[model samples]
Target: MGADRVGSGRGRVGRTGAYAVCGAVLLAGCASMPDSGDLRGVESTARQDTQVRVFAMPPHENASPSEIVQGFLEALTSDDTNYETARKYLTTAAGHTWRPELSTTVLEDAPETNAEPVGSREEGEEFVFSMSGSKVATVDAQQSYVPVTGAYSRPVHLTKNHEDGQWRIDALPQGVVMGKSDFQRNYMSVNKYFFASDAEAGQSPQPAAVADPVYVRRRVEPMTQMVRSVLKGPTKWLGPVVRSSFPTGTALQAEGDALAPDDQNKLTVPLNARAARVGQGRCEEMAAQVLFTLQNLTPAVDEVELRSGGKQLCSLTEGSHADAVAALTSAQEPDYLYFVDGDHRLVRLSAGSGDTKAEPAPGALGEGEKALRTVAVSRDEHTAAGVRLDGKALYVGALVSGGSLGDPVLRSEGKTEENRLTAPSWDVRGDLWVADRDPANPRLLLLEKGAGEPVEVETSGLDGRVRAVRVAADGVRIALVVEKDSRRSLLIGRIERGGKTDGRPTVTVRELRSATPELEEVTAMSWAGDSRLVVVGREEGGVQQMRYVQSDGSAPEEQAPTALPGVEEIAACQDDQTPLVANSEDGIVRLPAGAQWRKVTEGTAPVYPG
Candidate 1:
C-alpha cells in the first residue's frame, strides 16, 4: 500500500525518524503514540535500514497495564523467531491460545493505543485498551501479500494476575500487527518457481517457469522457510496454472531441520520418501526448481543436491547449460526491438543499444509492401505479426529478407476503426493473441503458429470488451486491457486450455482480476519481470505516469521506474540488462539502464520480442 515515488532518492528509499530498541516499543518509541484520539493520522515511523539484530525485551515485574501493553507491542517487532518474549506480556491462558504466525497486518504507521474510559476497570476487573491504524496490506499464513485500504481497529483486554498482581494482556488478535517500515525491515519478498501446466503436459517445446512471490522473515532461517514454502506449493490464486515439481505429501525427512549451504557452496536438501519415489528425470526437475527459486536469494547456493531417506536423488548446478531443467526454463534475451516507422513500415534496432540505427525488418512487412500500425515479434525473432494501418487486416511474415506477405491471416468486420483488431502478442507456445473491438461482435482470438482459423477464447466472468492483449512468456497468464463503460483497466487472467483429449485444446481466459486498480485507465503494459509489469496509465483525475506493479497488485516503492512524458506504447524485456523502449512526445525513446530517456528515432508502437 506504500506508493513508490520514482527517484525517491539516496540511501534507504523511504526511511526517517528515531527508533529505540531498548524498550519504548516499535524498535523504540514507534507507537510513541497518542492515547486519546481514535484516528489513524500519525506519520510513518519508518526505521533506518540497518542490519543490526534487535531482540524484544521481556516484561518488567509489577509493570502497569499501559507499560505491559506497550512492551508487548514492541516485542512484536523484535527478532524472536517464535515470539517467546512477546508472550511474556500475555496471560498464561492467552499465551497458550495465541497463534502469532497465522497472519501479519501491515499499517501505514505504528499502531497507537487509546486508553479505555476512566473508571472502566474496577479494582479486580480487566483493563481494555483500543488499538488502531490505517491498514496497508496483509500477509497470509502462506505469505501471499495483498494490498488493503482503510482503518485497522482492534481491542486488547488487560488483566491483573491474581497471584503476582502484575498486569498482562488476556485477549487480542491471532497475528501480529506492525507498521510498514518494520514490515519491510523484518521481511523480504522471494519468488518460488513452478512449471506451466500446459508445458508439463508436453504441449510446449520446453517447460517455462512462472514465478510466485511470497514474503518471509528476513532473519528467521529464511533458507529453510523457503524450502518449506516450495514444498507447500503455489498460492491459491496461481495454483490453477502452475504445477510444483515436488510430489504431493513430500516434505523434509525430519522436522525443525535447518538448510544451509556447505563451505563448498552446495546445498543438500533431505526430502521424504514421497519425494524420492520420483524417477531420475523428475528428481532433477525438483532440484532445478530449488536452484531457480534461490538464485536471487543468496550466493551461497551455487548448487543443489536432493536426498531422501539417506539416498541421493539428483543434483543441479548453476550455469550448467546441459542440465535439462536449466535449458527448459531459462529465458533468452531479445535480439532486437521492433516498431512502426513514420512510413508505417516495421523497423528494428539492436536491443539495449541506444546508438544503433533503425532498419526495416527482414520480411515483407519490413519490405514496406503495406503500411502497418502495430507489431509483435516471436520470441525466436524468426517471425513477425502486424496489424494493417487501416486496422482491419492482420499479417504474418518471416523475419527473413525477400519474404512476401501473401494473404491476411485475420480480419475484423467492425464498422469503425475503434472496433478493429488490437495489436498482436506472442506467447512462448508460439501462438499469437489479439482482440477484435467490434461493438457488435467483439472477440479475443488466438492463432496457432500465426496461421489458420482464429480461436475465440472463452471469457466467462469478464464484464468488459478486450481492448488489448499480452500473453505471458509462460503462456498460462494473460494480461488484457479491458474497457467497461468509458474506462479501460488492466486485468490479469489465467489461460486454461481444455479438450486436449481431441487433440485441439480449447482456451479460456478466466479469473480476470485487476492488476492496477488504483489507475482509472491503463493505456499500455508489458511484462517487465517474471512477476511484475511496467504499465502506463493514470489514476482518477491524475496525469499519465509509468510505474511497476506486481501480478498480485503490490507496487513496491523501491523499484519505481523513472518518469517519461506522453508515452503511448511501452516495451520491456525480461532481461533487466536491456533498456526500456517507448513511444513518447520525443517519438520512439530508449531508457537505458541507469540513464534518462533519449530519442531513438521517430516511430510508434515499440515492442520487444515476446
Candidate 2:
C-alpha cells in the first residue's frame, strides 16, 4: 500500500487557480439557506434520525475501538490503488480536503493508540471536492518543479449541531498528513515482487532450480552463524576447551569400593556380605576391578603393570601417583579403576583425558584415618558412599578440594542391634538402611538425621530370613530378598514414619522361579523404576537369570538366561539405567540400558575377578 508523486508544473498558480476554483464550488451550494423555522424543525428531525440509526446498529462486534481505527488505517494504506471504499465513511468535506498529491505511501504502520473515548462534540458540516497533484511552482518567478501528492477528508461536528440542521467541517487537519518519498516508491516495487510471484505460490523459483548447491549453502548459512554465536562464551566453550586441553590418555586414579563374590570356602563369611577390596586397578577395566592388600603383603608386582586385551598398555610406576589415581578414577567414556591401599582404604578411579581425580578414602570420609571397607559410587558419580571399619557408614562425601584424600562431609553410624553393627545400604536421599540379623524378630533399621535410634521396620511376615536389603529411590520403600523355608522370595514394603503398621506399610512378595518349575533362591534384587525391580538368581543348574518384576502387577518379565561367565558375585548398580554385575574371577560388567553386557573393570584378589 503505497503511492508516489512527481513534478508536473513549473510555475506557481495564481490565487484564482489555487484556492478560488475549489472554494467557489464549495460555497456555491451554501449561498442559500432554509428559513429559520424550517431549519429548526429539520434539525430536530435529523437528531431523532441520527439517534435511531445509532441505536439500531449492533454493538461494535469488532475487537475494540482501537482495532477498528487500525483496520481503517490499514485499508487506506493498502496497495489496491483505489481508496474509495475506505473514504466512503468519512465526511464529504474531509474527502475533498485530502491532499493526495502531497501524501506519500505509508512506510510503516504505527502502533495503535491506547486513548479511549471521552465523548465527542461536532461543529457544522460542509460538503467539498478537490483534486491536486505535484507541481513545480515558483513563488518568486523562478520556476522549480516541486513534487506533491494530496488527499481529502471531511470532519463533522455533532455536538454543536444539536439545535440546528447544520454541521461544519474544516479542511482535513494537518496532523493527519502522511509523508511520501522516493524510498517508498522503491519499497513498493519490492513489495510487489514478493507478493505477486510464483515463488509466493509455493513454486520453486527458476534460480533455485538451477543452483541447488548455492541454495543449500544459503539455507544453512543462518544456522551456522547462530552456532558460532552460541559457542563464543567462556562458560559455553569450557566443556570443549577442557576436552581438547586434557585430550585422551592422561593417567588418573582414585580409590573406591569394589564388590567381590562371597567365598563359600569361608564358613564365617556372611552369605550376603561379599569380599571388599581396596587397591589400585586400571581405570579402563571393563570387568570387576578390585584391589586388595593383606597385612604386610604386597600385591603381585606383575599385577601392577597396566594391561589391555592381554597386552601391556603402560607400566604402573611410569606415572606419578597422583596422575595414576587421576587416570584410574576417570570414567569418562566408561573407563574406571577400583583401588585398595595397604591400610584397607578403598577408592574408585575414573581416568578420562582430564585431570579430575576422586579419592574416595580421605576425600569423602573427611580427616579420617579409619580404613574404608565398602564403597559405592552412584551411576552419576556425583554421589559416593562408603562404610568405615569402625562399623560406621559415611556418605555424601566429595573428593578433596585438590583431588587428594580428605574427610567426608557427612558421617553416620551403622545399624546396631544387641551390640552388633550391620553394614547399611545408602538410599538416594542419603539415608541408610540395614537389616538386623535377629532371626525371631528381624527388622530394617532406618537411619536419618535427628533420629537417635534406628527406626525399626518389622519384617515378620516376609516368610524367610532377610538375606539382603535395599531401599527404593524415594527412601520410603524397602526391598528385601528373603530366603523363606529354602525358597527365595522378594518382599517389598513401605516404611512407616511413626513405626506403626496399621496397613500403611503393606508388604508384598513374589517368588522367583528356577528352570525346573521350582522357586529359585534369589541372589540379588535392584529397583528398575518406580514400579519395577530387576532380580538376579541362580537356577538349580547354576544358570544365572535376571527377571524384571513389576511391583504394580502389570506384568512379569525375564531376560534370557545369561551365563554368569567367570563371575560368582552379582549386584545391581543403584541406577536403573544400567545394571552392575561383578565377577569373582574377572571384573565388573555394566549392562547398559537396552544394550548388551560390557565389562567395566577387573576384580582384585581376596576380591574375586568375577
What ranges in model 2 sit over 4 Å off?
1-344, 349-368, 376-385, 388-423, 438-442, 450-452, 499-518, 540-542, 552-561, 566-579, 592-596, 604-610
Clashing pairs in 1: 20-27, 20-28
lDDT of 2 by residue, 1-610 (tens): 1000010211100000000111100001111222111211000011111111111111123222222233333333222223443343333565576543333322212211222222431122223222122221101101001122233232222111235333322333322222122122111100000011111111112110000000001111212211121112111111111111111332122112211222321101011111122123322121111110100011111122323333333322212332223221111122333444335554544432222243443363333445655454433234344556553444345444333334442343325432223334554334456665555555655554312345555554455566666654434346776666676666665443432354333322223212112227666555543334556665566666665554322222234325455544445422222234444344555454455666654432111000
Please report, as a residue range, the 10-residue window in candidate 1 with the lowest summed lDDT: 11-20
Instruction: Give stretches of model 1 more than 4 Å off.
Output: 1-45, 117-122, 200-205, 321-323, 326-330, 500-504
TM-score of 1: 0.89
Cα deviation of 442, candidate 1, in Å: 2.7
User: How many Å off is the CA of 484 in candidate 2?
Assistant: 3.3
